[model samples]
Target: MSIHTFQLHDLEIGTLHDLLLDAVSDTKWKIKELRQTFDQTDQAALLEKLSSIEFNKARLETYTELLEQIDSSWCPDE
Candidate 1:
């Protein structure tokens, strides 16, 4: 989860695809939470929201790289 280094070659293609789907789900959920929080929040809430947004951004970046790696090696089912 360092957003850079990994040996994904050990994983099954289907499993890797599931991970991709999970990333999609996570980002979607975080985006919704951030949207709601920003619409109405106090200073304290704003700080927490910023932290959450940072985590979401990192996760999004990780998955983006994962996506590119997967895309590079993708193939049709045999």
Candidate 2:
């Protein structure tokens, strides 16, 4: 599998939020597909991958919530 690299600082919060949501969705689908085809030999590795993906998803959710709060609370001076 190939991992894509990005300069996260270049992206706006909303863009990053969208990207993270897409990533979480994709990773979750991959996890579900892998679970369907899992065997005894793949159990450890598969579970590890799923756990990592879940952790990332949780982190993304936290970040998204934080961004939402910031967006809602922030007030720009006119």
Residue-level lDDT of model 1, residues 27-58, one tens digit each, is: 67766776777787666776776676576577
- Global local distance difference test of model 2: 0.66
Residue 53 of model 1, lDDT score: 59
- lDDT (CA) per prediction: 0.68, 0.66
What local lDDT score does residue 20 receive in model 2, on the 0 to 100 scale? 72
Worst 10 residues of 2 by lDDT: 1-10
For model 1, name the residue pairs that clash.
none
Write down the RMSD of all candidates, one decimal each: 3.6, 4.8
Work out the TM-score per prediction: 0.57, 0.49
List, residue by residue over 41-73, the lDDT tens digit for candidate 2: 577777777776776676666566656766786
Clashing pairs in 2: none
